[model samples]
Each structure stands twice: as C-alpha cells, then as structure tokens.
Target: MSQVPMITLNNGVQIPQVGFGTFKVDAAVTQQAVENALEAGYRHIDTAAVYGNEEGVGAALRAVNLPRDEVFVTTKLRNGEQGRDLVQRAFEESLGKLGLDRVDLYLIHWPAPALGTYTEAWAELESIHRQGGARAIGVSNFLPHHLETLVEGAEVTPAVNQIELHPSFQQPATQAASREHGLAVEAYAPIGQAKDLDLETVTGIAREHDVTPAQVILRWHLQQGTVVIPKSVTPERIVANIDLFGFELDEEQVAAITALDSEERMFPHPDEGNFTMLD
Candidate 1:
C-alpha cells in the first residue's frame, strides 16, 4: 500500500495530503466506492451532508474494520444549516447518520453570505470543537473576503478552507490569503473535474513525466502544498489517484501548470449568494 503524505493544519491536526472525495457519488454505490479507496490505501475521506452519502460512508467505515483513529473522516454542515443553533443540531444529526461519535473534521460547507449567519455558524463550530464533537473545524467555498470577515470576529482561526481549486483555477489570491492566516487549503476538484486535464499543457507535462494527465495534475497540487481530494467511483481510478507520491514535478513543469490558471471557477462563486441548494 502506498503511504499518503500528511500535512499539519494550523491547529496541529494532521491530514492526509491526498484524500478520497464523495461529492457526486451516488448513495447506492458510495459504500463500495469508499471501500475500494480504503483498500487502495486512502486513509482520508471527505464527504458533505448535502452529498447524501454519509450513511453509506459510515457503512463502509464499519465494514473496513480498521481502528477508527486510523482513518480520518470529514463532513460538512449544509448551507441551510448555517446559524449557531441550527449548525449544532445539524452536526448531531450528521453524526447520527454517520454513526460516529465525532468526525476528524467538520466544516461549515459554504459562506452563504446572503443568509448572514456564517460567522455565527463558525462560532458554533468552535463550540463543537471545544466540546470535542469535532476534532477540527473549518469552512468551505469561502473566499478570502469571507475568511477575513470570519477572522475579524472569530476567536479561533479555521483549521482549513476547502475550495474549488485546480490548475485552471489556481486561486493564487485566495491561496495566499489562506497561507497568510495559517489555514490549510484543501482543493476540491483537484484534477479540474476533468475540465482541463486534456489541455495541451497538462498532457504535454504528462508525456514528459510518463504519467497520466490526472496524475500530473494531482502531483501539481501536492507540490503546491495543497491537500487534494479526487473522487472517482471506478476502482482503477480510485487506486490510481492515490498512486501520486512516487513522482515529483520539476519547477518548469509546475510553473507551466500554474500558468494555466485563468481564475475561471467551475462552481458557483460563494459571493454570488446562491444558496439554491437549500431549495
């Protein structure tokens, strides 16, 4: 089994640099997919309440029979559950669904700035962390400005900021801001969700490195000091995604991929205030 590298978060929690994500995975197959990932050597698993697969994830974890502490699990508070009281309740409900006492990490899934309660939600997450409901607390889909608002009033800095990042959308400004505040950046869609893997630059680099474009892209993320969660239901891809530690990218190759950044985001902008997921 390949050993995944770990990155220490600002709060001193250690997370695997490469993780398996269960974003769009169907609940029916989520268990088997996660099991395949674990059997393939992935110890970190990222899921969200809105993803509708927490139960499946729980089932897989139980089936694997590994010591609970040996694996890291992360889940999020849905956009609809954005206030202090609601977040607390939502977290308990998520725990119930996952059948776990606590998650390794719990995240406020999005800023939902229109709701005007993300900061309050952050406070609740802090309370949960204090009470040991979550080992670590953080936010997702949060822009630097949103993080600034959070930091101004927050008593504890977020351990991480999960964002939609890829070679095509490097988010240098956001990445820099996260580093400035000592928050670890976790990249969702680390392989561009297949959006730019076929680009000439990525493919050319892959050819030079004798790796698939996906491997090249994931390696780029790892080299940039970001945690990446690449999701796949296919067994081969799940196994292949974690097979990233064997190679390293040269500075020019890394720069060529970095230059592919145009700041084009594939997901909704957090500032746009779309909480349509609540609907």
Candidate 2:
C-alpha cells in the first residue's frame, strides 16, 4: 500500500493530500467502491448531497469497521440549500445520511452568485464550523473573482477551494489566489478524466517514469502541493492511483507537465446563464 501525504489547512487542521472522489459514482455501487478505496488506503472520501450517495459512503465506512476518527469524510451543501436558514437543515440531512455526528469537511458545492445566496451560505458554513458540525469548511469550483467576492462578504475565510484542475487546465490565477489567501487548492480532475492521456507530453512523462499516464498526471498535482482526488471504480486502477508516493517527479519533469496548461475546463460551468441545478 502507498502512503498518502497530508496538507495542513489554514486553520491548522491536517487533511490528506490525495483522496477518493465519488462524483458520478452511482449510489448502488458506491458502497463497494468506497470499501475498495478504504482497503486500498484512502483515508479521505469526497462526496456531495448532489451525488446522492452519502448513505452508501456511510455504509462503507461502517462496513470497514475502522474507527470513525480514522477516516475523513466530506460532503457538500447543494445549491437548493444555500441560505443561512436552509443550510442548517441541509447539514443535518447530510449528517444523517453519513451516520456521523460531524463531517470532516463541508463545502459550498458551488457559488451560485446570480441567486445572491452564497454570501448567506458562507455565513452558515462558518456557523457550522464553529458549532463543530464540520471540522473544516470550503468552496468548490470557485474562481479567483468569485473567491474575492466571497472574501469580501464572508465571515470565515474558506479553508479549501476545490476546482477543476489538471495538466491541461492549471488555473494559475486560482492557484495563486488560493495560496495568497491561505486556502488549500484541491484538484478535482487531476488526471484530466483520462482525456489527455494521448497528449504527447503526458505520454512522454509516463514513459520516462515507467508508470501510467494517470500516475504521471497525479504526481504532477502532488508535486505542485495541490490536493488531488482522482476517481476510479476499478479496483486495480484504484490501487495503481494510490501507488504514487513511491516515486518523485524532478523539477524539469514538473515544469514539462506544468507547461501543458491551456486554462481550459473539462466540466461545464455550474454558473452559466444564471442557470443552476436547483432550477
């Protein structure tokens, strides 16, 4: 088993640098997938209310029989539940599904600024953090401009900003802003969803490292000090993804991968045309 590294948040809490993400994972198969990830040594699990698999994830944690404190579970506040008053209900519902008294981290799934609700949501997150319902709080898919507005209106600085980051779309501006604000940067699609494997640069690195393209990509994220969550349902791939700490990418290799950034995003904007999942 590979040893995963840990990063310290702005509030001085430690979180795993690499985690297992359950984004599109079906609820019916989520329990077994999570169990496999746990067995493969993933201490962190990233989920969301929108994913509709918290109950499955919770079942895995329970089935693993690991001490509750041994694993770090994170769930997000979905768009529909984005106000101060509604957030309390949302958090409780997530907790109930996870069967945990408190989640390790809770995130504002997205900043639906057009609706003008994230400001209220941030306050509710701060309240949740203070009340110990969530050990840490963060935002997802937030750009620098969005973060700035959030900071201006937020009472607590978000501890982490989860975004679509990979070799092809590095988001340097977001990374710089996160570093400047003491918010940890988390890469949601560090392997480019395996879409960039055929890229010459990525293939070249994988050959040099004697590893798979996905491992090379993940190593790049780790070298940049960005937390990465790469999802895979296959057990062999899950094991292979976690086997990254054994090797190190040199400066030249890191730069080679970093140079591939085109600032493009693979996922569609959750904030386009004032449309939202809630609607």
Candidate 3:
C-alpha cells in the first residue's frame, strides 16, 4: 500500500528508489518471495548471476501477469565472466534464465581488479546498452579507484554503482566518487544485515520517527539520494520495507545516523579479490 519513489539515472532512465533484493535467497523460495514483493508494489527487482536464482525470478515475473515494461529487473555479470566475449555469453545466459529479452539494468557484479578485465567487460555492457539489451548498465562493489580505472577509456559513464552501503559502512568516499561521475548509488546491504539496527543511535532515531530501526536506516538511505535494495523473504518485512514514504528523517536525525558510520564493511572488500564464488 506504499508507493516507491523513482530516481533518475544518468541516462535519464528512472528506477524505483527502493527495490527488492534477492541476495542469499534460496532458489526454491525465490519465486514466491518475488511474487510477494511484486504484489506488495515493488516494481524493481535486483538479482545477480552469482545468486543462482535467476530462473526462479524469471518464473515469478512470468507468473505475475504484469506488463514487461511495468517492472524493472536487474541482474549482474559474474566475476568469472569478466572478459568481453565471456560477458556477452553470460548476459545471454542470464537473459535465457530470466526469460526476458531485455533487463532494466545490467551491472558488472564486481571489478575483480586482480583479474584485470573489468574495462573490457564494461565495453561489452556498453554494447548491450546500445543494442537495447539493457536499459542501463552499472558496476557493483566498485571502489573509487576501481571506477577511475573503468572510466579512463570508456564511452558511457556507468549509470549506477551498487555497493556495500549501510549505516555502519556509509562509504562516503565511494559515494562521493559515484556522485562526481553522475552515477546513482545503489545500496546493496542497506539495512546493515541487522548488525547495527539495534545500535542506540539507530533505535533512538527509530523511536523518534516511530518506525523500526530498519525503516529508519532505509529512510536515511533514501534521504541521502541513494537507491536501496533491502533483501527479505518474509512477506511482512517485504511489505514493511517499501512502506517508507510516510515519514521523513530530520536534518539532525540524518546527521546522527550519518555519524554512525564506522567505516566497516559487511562484505569482503572488492580489492581483496575474493573470487572464490566463481570457483
């Protein structure tokens, strides 16, 4: 019953500010979860090749009976498939799994800097965008330095940069870098994985706003002009996550939440080159 606001990407494409994230969601249950999200008015759905649930997501999309253009679907290229040739094949494979000809957004899942092939992979994404296979293209888990390497010889600036952003790990430098390049920031772990939802600052703000700490954190993300994809398989939480339009966090509340940034990451640093998932 809540309306999700849309944010304009650099390419003039509008995306829902809050989306449903399918990370760590079991493939067996993904379809139902996505169905619930769509029913709850989540038009944007974010998943990745690494999540291994694209097939289920596709099934849900097909089952929903909504117009294809009514929903915004995003999937990412896997780390192993980082070369131009491999990326093309990977995109086709993801498309086949999703049962859709075009995705609303396509992202390079990670820079995988050690592999040293992201620039080439980015070229392939640009081609996909030009050919209309993807409405917009972006990168995930990319730090400022990684983005710098990507844009050196690139033709199209990345439309979005999905990163490990939450209250505890605000990623100010990376967020600033993204804004500098006209890239929209998408917060992947926007709720901090429930790690800091109970922090005094978060709870105090939640109490002041009379909402859950998760909602407060998500509101903070929204107020900061970032897109947030909070993952939840529970139907109630899925409904609650998008019910964020009613309240607004004040300047001091926003500053208090901003001060909670501890510079800690819930996921591995991109520079660590943790591509074991590819294996």
Candidate 4:
C-alpha cells in the first residue's frame, strides 16, 4: 500500500486524504467496483443512503476482510429523511446495511432548508454521535448560513462538511466557514465530473509531471488540504486516483490551479426542485 496522506479531523481522527466515493454506482455493479478500489489500497470508502448501494459496499467490505480499524467507512442521512425521528431511523438503516455498529463518519446528506428540519436533524446526529453510533458527525452541501445555524444549536460541532469542490467550484465562502468552525472539509466531485480531465491547464500539468490529468487534479486537492473522494468503477482508474502522493505541486502551480475556481456546482441544489422530500 502507498503511504497515502492523512487529514486530522477536529476530534483528532486521522482519515485517509483520498477516499473512493461510491455515488451513482449501480447497485448491481457496486460490489465489484468497491472491491477493486479496496484492492487498489483505498482505505476510505464513502457511501450514502440515497446512493442505494450500502448493501453492495458492505458486501465488498466482507469480501476484502481487512481489519475494521484499517479502513474508514462513511455514510450520510438522505435529504428526504431529514428530521429528528426520520434521521434516527435512516441512520439505523444505513448501519444495518453496512453491517457496522458505528461508522467512522456520518453526515446529513443535505441541509434541506426548504423542508425546514436540518437543525433538528443535526441534533439527532449529535445524539447518534453521543451514543457512539458514529465516531464523527457532519453535514453535506451546507452553505455558510446553514452552518452558522448548526453551530448555534448543535451541542457538538460537526467534524466535517462535504461539498462539491472541484477546481471550477471552489466554494471559498463555505470553506472559510468550515475552517472557522474547526470543521474539516471534504470535497466531492473533486475531479469536476470529468470536466477538468481535458482542460489545457490540467493536461499541461499532468504532462509536466508525467502523470494523468486525474492524478494531477487529485493531487491539487490533497495539496490544498481537502479530503477528496474520487469515484471510479474501473480498476485502473481506482489505482490511478490514489497514486498521487509521489509528487508535489509548488506554490505557483497550486495558485494556477486555484485560479480555475468559477463556483460552478454540477449538482443543482435540492431546493430548486431537483429533489422532493418524503414523509
């Protein structure tokens, strides 16, 4: 296994800087895909109830048979399931499917401001963490205002806030709030959903380093101190994503990549009718 870098959470847990995200992976194909990522030496696995693949991911875990502490597993509370009661039930369902008594990290998949219950749901997650059901609890896709409310009402500070953070969607304001609150930042779609794969700047950097564009981008996220989850079902890409610790990006190169932030969010907000809440 490569010496993958680790990011220290607020509670001081060291999580692998790069994780394998099993988002949108077909349930039928997820088991093999996750198994391939594990074989590639990925120590972190990110899944969610909305992804509908916790069972498949759990199967991969059993197949790998790696010691529990050696791998970090994370899951999230889905949008429709955001509430005191529903959130508690949703978490139990995820835990049951993942076949784990406690998750390394658990999160509110989205704030669901429109539904008007994330604050209460956050309190529920705080309870989950207190009960030792999850080592760390956090939120996803939350804006600064959302986080402020969470901080004001939450008994426990969220250890992380996972969001869309590709080069084009840097989310500087959100990142600032997370930092101010002592929350670790986790970047989903860190490679920009393949949008940055062929960009001249990214490709040029890859060529200069004799690495793939994907590797270059993942390296940029790591250097920026963001926990990145790059999802790939292919075995070769799984190995390629984590093979980034061998090189370093200097200040100028890092700045050039940082300049690519355009705040473009590939996934539309749930409030914009992209999703509907269920009772």
RMSD of each: 1.1, 1.4, 1.2, 1.4
For model 2, how does the per-residue alpha-carbon lDDT over 56-161 read when each residue is reduced to its tens digit?
Answer: 9999999998988778888998887896779999999999999999998999888777878888889989999999999999998888888898898777899999
Give each model's clash number.
0, 0, 0, 0
Off by over 4 Å in 4: 270-274
RMSD of model 3 against the true structure:
1.2
Point out the worst 10-residue segment of candidate 3 by lDDT.
Answer: 270-279
Give per-residue CA lDDT, model 3, range 141-189, as digits (tens): 8999999988888899999999998888888999999999999999998
TM-score of each: 0.97, 0.96, 0.97, 0.97
Q: Kindly give the stretch of ten consecutive residues in candidate 1 with the minimal lDDT sum.
A: 270-279
Best by the lDDT measure? 3
The reply for model 2, stretches above 4 Å from the true place, is 270-279
* Winner on lDDT (3 vs 4): 3
Comparing 2 and 3 on TM-score, the stronger one: 3
Model 4: worst 10 consecutive residues (lDDT sum): 270-279
In the range 45-153, model 1's lDDT, one tens digit per residue, is 9999999999999999999988998899999999888866788889998999898999999998888888888889898999999999988999888888998999999
Model 1 segments more than 4 A misplaced: 276-279
Better of 2 and 3 by lDDT: 3
lDDT of 1 at 125: 92
